[model samples]
Target: MNKFGVSAQTLIAAAFGAAIMGSAFAVPKLLAPEAGAQPIAIQAPPGAPLSFADLIEKVEPAVVSVNVVSTQDLSELGDMDQFFEQFRGMPGLEDFFEQRREQQEQETPRTREARSLGSGFFISQDGLVVTNNHVVERATQIQIVMSDGREIDAELVGADPLTDLAVVRVKEPGPYPYVKFGSSKDIRKGDWVVALGNPFGLGGSASAGILSADGRELGAGSPYTDFLQIDAPINRGNSGGPTFDLKGNVIGVNSQILSPTGGSVGIGFAIPAELAKEVTDTLIQNGRVSRGWLGVQIGDLTPEFAEALGIEDVKGALIADVTTGSPAERAGLKRNDIILSVNGQKVTDSTSTTRLVAKLIANTKNKFDILRDGKPQSISVTVGERPADPNAISPVPGGANPAEPGAPSAVPGKMLPDFGVRLSPMDDATRIALGLRTGDTGLAITEVTKGGVFGEAGFEPGIIILDVNSRPVASVDAFERAIAEAKAANRSKVLLGLRVGQVTSYRTIDIPK
Candidate 1:
């Protein structure tokens, strides 16, 4: 009986083991699709794949890690901080903040070695790399590292601060992988994109995202400044990297982000490939970019102004001032004229108009459509080279006459009133009272009339007026000179450059002539 029981148990054990083995073999066969059959014909909905593995495989080799090393002298850091802080207000606290920040940066070392790591990509097989100008701006040494762990020294070929792009060159030439430029204009919102960069200095890092927005203006930070905003995970070291389309084309160059915590908030900005490509080409060809310029100071058309001019809406850039002898003035672009379009393309804002005009080849004759007194007018003007000095105010030659000695005291008629501030010449006492440095020069306000033009214009008694109608006014004489020129020209508004506290700023006001 015992022998019979043992035999039965052994047979049952053998049967159970065979069943388990058979189940394992059956499961794999069932899960694996048959070679002759398809994936059940499951339809992938119309959109990009949820995974970026294919993108990484296609674009990773084109991306490179950029390492920059710069030196910051202790005194220079203190001075730069002080200079910028003065413009941000709290002039008295400038030195205090600088000292504290310098100490902190020195002790804990925000960047003692002055090392910055960013990402860039090859534009040509001969080892030409394109990146953000800020990435390698002050770097004394630059190292480019490839994906296969090859490091090589790179030389800065050229950089354009206005467009925020830099070009660098590596010594070795090869059948190097690179990306072709794509038209950013064709990219709409919600387009799939893959960002390749060295995020946190981790080489060959990639993240996929979509174009969240386009034509984002960051507010006068750069001259040629239409940016494509993306929701990619671009971090500190991601600047200068390439944002690639699904076809592995370089669509944009990742530039900036709106982050307060110094980390990726998934809102990254890219210089559109359209803009970057032009700059890169110029840099590669001439070692610098030459941008065309139409010399005019423009203002956003306000509702009141638009209605006054019989414009249906604020749709065009209003000409506030035209530089004397400049292309605009030469082409008869008068003050108060609304710039409706540039080269026949409607301009809705200053940024778009500026960008359009910039893209014009230098010395090319372009047509500017304008609206004056409710009538459309066309003016032809030749675009000229942008002035090298942004700070040098264009002079209004013979625009004002010298006030006759012993003449009746002329008071401006229709003295629009508000805060009762008056314009006067800057003196030692006034400068000391206003806490102005010796280098400061402008028409200082000594007193205020109750609700007068000075008040209406948002002027304070201690404020110094530097420029009127885009013309520099270093003294009371120059201020009066500018006012006379505006009256003679029948202009109703003037833009003033001001030096308040310790920093230079600008404001626009309407002056009834």
Candidate 2:
């Protein structure tokens, strides 16, 4: 008001008038009581409970806090002499540096006891407790703290890292309060769930929220688990806890959460009870779970891949490379074959196929329906036990040595300006570098024009084009013939099988009209 050159008294009077008017209209509407209006009260929807206290009391006894003590190496801390070198020549600093050097020289390999906490629940009357594999991994000693403050020693019965589940047995046996796994399939999206655990080392904590979603895949770490997403506030110590349904049945096991602040953001994941129960049962019986192995590198059949392959539906797993001597190779499965179904179960994608195959019994004959060379065929093969370390099985034998000695340095090639790529005939040096076996024919990429179609498709020099539309291509003329045939058939896309590094994969490229 002062800067606008208006009188202070007048401005104050005007502001007072506006405030009076605003309050005159807003006060009655917001705060004034109406004669017949009952006091406003929020009510829960019909059938919803006002509180979860009853459910909490019934299931809290089964919940326990898992205390783990493990060893942590501190040997790296003994190398600090280099940091004090500049101060060595300073006045009156010689004694300090000498003492520090002596301490470092006297120090041996050091270690410390690291303590961590998680949660778990009893699953049987004979003291069979189920928790997460991570909770007890590398643990030198494990202690279970009960809800009533009773401490008991426990021994690891079995642990499955793939599913992040483990079973432990109490040293002193008794009829413990245990919970049973319920059917996660019956839980709807909006169904209520109660998570009981020890969050932040606070024992006997409980949280309730609706099931946010189901069948959420959280990347490669949990490839076999289709996690159930929940809005419950689960923190660090909540891992291995139980997520219970309204009927006090354990439906899921809290495993991970998505948060940037290291706290709950209402996005948490749980392993469904069905898978948990199955894995726990297997661990109890065999101390480990054995999965079926098919020995094939598979990928999802995307729309572009489907169109290039002349398939109508993109709902199967595409075989990229079949490992030599694997069950798949023994069964006559090959690269570029699309797996349609496994033992009458429709293959949806690579993940679904992986889960289905893992559920199969090892050494049992299983039927596989596949589309090979645009024709449907059936094959039977006995599933083999999956290797404990998945990386033990190489997709293909031999290593690439692109710069082999005594090889030709230059070779004649073809340049496709329209596609923005130069193709060269595969030489012995390139074959050895690509780890290709004998009789493998292909054209190698020599150069790619930046911002061109091939370059935009991620084609790089040294990549070997193995096949075009499932037809092996050895020369530029063969490639041209395959493209001409595709154009003649009115195909808009062509599938190219490529060998990059030591592995092989398929990519589809668009054809210009």
Candidate 3:
């Protein structure tokens, strides 16, 4: 009585059994028997069967309802209470304040009650659990409720927003059931899957679905999401729950969905279990994930740009800017270089490139294959640990200075046309006058037109350009060389490395060839 018709072997066995029993008790006790006139018992084949009940029972203990509560400060609550008290004289205001005061008093001890529900799966017996970062973000109190009516307080261990994964530790250590991560890469597109979570606070709920897609790009909003799409019924509260395969292995963590009504329309997204495993391991060890800094801004290679670069196919990402003194620069990456692969793995686009680099363990060495001037070249690069908030302003090599109003042109002999603005060589007197530091160098703007490209690019006449197309431009000839190379390669745009005040940064703009 399985879903399908009885197997041939089973039918043959039944025939044999019927032949041996004849007509006497063939129909009476064929499946089961006793002594004297006892019939033989039917035996099933030798392999283990796929049972959903067994898998669910085994993994249910690992899945938990994660509740987060945040509180407001006492002073803020008191201020609000007083403000409402002052409005008591107004009509209905007194009643409102009375009710508000009662509610405030009830919530006073806690100060605030910001409740959010998600799901998590235990990973270690000593109380380590994994869930989505959004689940417990900014939560002052986190509680994990087990299936057996047991609630344990959880503490934040670490989280990676890029991967949307987090690790938490329970207050009391105990032997806890845990689930293992499986190879999401081995899962086929139409594979059966299950999602376990507290959807809408409905605890320990399980929904069945099929794997709809993999390696899906959610968007650039999250630069690291290589989502696995499924038809599982996941919702807001399901954000951090485990998505399991038939074998009871965790394959993903439900993260997002594409729904117009905030309900499951058979479209849900999850962070793949592989990525989650890597992130959790790093966070557990270092308290934070350390990403590799490629020091390059990249964009998708266009068909025109691909043809210009003599590429048979437009499959690689185009390099827009290679930061000076960065790993990319030290590895000899340049603007207009097309990155095809990292460490021999193909990249689909710039986002994939970034994610792959970000996933690399910090301070690791890898090989990069890039296309330069239509020729493939491989370079060895040792990635550096990404600095926290790399955009923080620091002392630049030179100073930043804008010329005084009606000031005369300082370097008249060296000038270049930039978006109808004239840029001239930087001088020590101009730097001193504009409060520009000595470390700042390169061409400074001498003049600009109103509503010109220079203004659109946020450039004033006095700002200096340090590098063009990832090449240092100490003189006007170097600047021309960079521009000439870009034009010769038919690149649509080029990046300029500039120094302004204590800030050193880059900007990419179209090159009018």
Residue lDDT tens for model 1, 414-502: 22233245455565544444434344455766566755666666666556676665455665567667767766766665566665653
* Candidate 2 segments whose C-alpha is farther than 4 A from its true place: 1-42, 72-112, 396-412
lDDT ranking, high to low: 2, 3, 1
Off by over 4 Å in 1: 1-45, 71-113, 185-187, 373-376, 394-513
| Best-to-worst ranking by TM-score | 2, 1, 3
TM-score against native, each model: 0.65, 0.84, 0.62
Candidate 3 lDDT over 125-209, as tens digits, reads 8889999898888889999999887999989999988778899999987999888999899888988888999999989998888
Candidates' lDDT values, in order?
Answer: 0.74, 0.86, 0.77
Candidate number that wins on lDDT, 1 or 3: 3
Best of the candidates, lDDT: 2
Error of 2 at 285 (Å): 1.0
Clash count, candidate 1:
8
Give the clash count for each candidate. Answer: 8, 3, 11
Report model 1's TM-score to 2 decimal places.
0.65
